[model samples]
Target: MPWTLPSRPSRRSLLAGAAGAAGAALLTGCSGGPGTADPDPAVSLERRMRASSVRDSERLLERYDATAAAHPALAERLAPLRAAVAAHTSALSSSGASDGSAAPSAPAAAPAPGAGPAVSGEPVPPKPEEALAALADAERSLAESRTVALAGAPGELARLLASVAACGAVHAYLLTPTPGAAS
Candidate 1:
């Protein structure tokens, strides 16, 4: 059998191939990166979630401050947990998309210098035990919220939120004392 030379491609076929390639590139480039005319659906959603998480952490910090201020005796115990929450806030505040996908929303606003935790018409419990319980409840609630939010987050943000949520859950557990243990 004689080896045959390949035929020169037809202009019609070449133009069709180029057009298809261009269309695919345009579609691929149109992905919802931040600052695009048509933003990615998840990018904006992630930004909102991230901003909300940061604010939640900040608010929790306020609660810790208020609780400590109310019951000076518990300040030492709450210090580490409060510090962790602050770190969570910082982490979320600084998070940005690494996948060339997003710009996280603006950072959460700082609480006022003298501003105490937002009061829902209820003061910090007078008793230290009650105050600790209240703090634990806040931690648990926020952790639950964050966990629920994980489904909506992009990969990196989801991972960060998951870690923070787990930390919050741990904080809740630590705030409460073991009844069976001797003081």
Candidate 2:
């Protein structure tokens, strides 16, 4: 006689086996199941910051582009700074992150009235030197923003913010007066 194979398990048998396995899993879970099911707060905060930074960078680039066009002299001084921000925005986008929020056409340019740092009463810069000094001030303020944003960021966002801050610092230095350079 030909060897006879055991019949395939019926649907009922398969269901019974599945149920048994599920019961065992449930019992194991009830005993000490993989800790709590709580979500990570850091992950959430990091996601928010990462997204916000992307949006801000995008908006700032556009703003600088527009401001640069409107004020050619200011724009000339700001070109490199704006370019750096554009690169940051591209990096954020490439990293598969960005806040969906549309930044306001004009982000808070000067400090809000009585918010924090007050705008100087000193006369506005009449030359590139003066403009560069002002640019340095703006870059510093942007650095502060990056710091605050990163304080609560997590994972990749924290890393990205650090990079952003370093870039801003570099921009500030670029705007500073070089030795032997005319003010």
Candidate 3:
């Protein structure tokens, strides 16, 4: 005989399921089976931003680990960036608005050539005297992301991402070197 679920569960049971689902959705958006209320677009955008931030941080950490392990000379400068990226990942994870995947595993730090004198990638390498320039670019893009997220994000998710975006702007500033200083 085919098993069939009860056509009508008790009201209390239904309410409990709803609350639990909501909580699960909040903690790990889309983790529950399909048909949950669509998350606000802003929330979706924020989740994307958080994921991007996590990835970027991981890359930075890998770079730092490689350089710190081999060159040691650049550790002072790269250490903070690595720490910041790790913190960014942590913040994104705790935002309670993640896309449900566990944080990306820390990659083995290979001696990938540092993003040299040339600017490569979206955020650009916050390095060589152009660090600030790179950060500005990242912030500008992140701002755009924030605007999108704000439009669709709701409640705590909006609040957290907004706060994180502000911090990202600050990070951009931090990445920039003082005037006339060698990179």
Candidate 4:
């Protein structure tokens, strides 16, 4: 017998073969499918990040209020920045709602007198200058934390955090008095 090559597959056979391969892919694509993971890990993570950010902002607000009350002399300077932090809280709270999680409530007023840094449990200094410096330190710390958190935060949330962090940095700068400059 002549060593003749086998003929190519027919069109019908080719179509059938392709269909079978597609079906196989579909069957295996979702192997161990239902409830394999936490449904949606990304959403869960985002919710957590949002909640953390809210809580941090609230704590910062507390620190601000406490410092203001503890030293009324600085209250006027802190008012605008405090308002900005409150706005950030509201903004963060509203954004979390889109993910189906109820936003955390806004923070309450400052704690009892002589209660220092609410965020870090540190004592608020008695001197107005020291108190402002302490508040600035808290802002810097929180801003640094938020910046670190940017790594895992989702797109919109990351952007929000970054903006808030920048604002915090600004607040810190403003809170710290300039050297040899008039008050």
Top candidate on TM-score is 4
Clashing pairs in 4: 116-124
Candidate ranking (TM-score, best to worst): 4, 1, 2, 3
Number of clashing residue pairs in every model? 1, 0, 5, 1
Minimum summed lDDT over a 10-residue window in model 1 is located at 104-113
lDDT of 4 at 33: 47
Model 3 root-mean-square deviation: 18.5
Instruction: Pick out the ten consecutive residues of candidate 3 with the lowest summed lDDT.
Output: 115-124
Tell me the TM-score of each prediction against the true structure.
0.67, 0.52, 0.47, 0.70
Show pairs that collide, candidate 1.
32-40
Cα error of candidate 3 at position 176, Å: 2.4
Deviation from native of the Cα of residue 134 in model 3, angstroms: 2.0
> Where in model 2 is the C-alpha error above 4 Å?
1-40, 73-77, 94-130
Residue 42, model 4, lDDT? 62
Error of 2 at 134 (Å): 3.4
Quote model 3's TM-score.
Answer: 0.47
Best by lDDT: 4
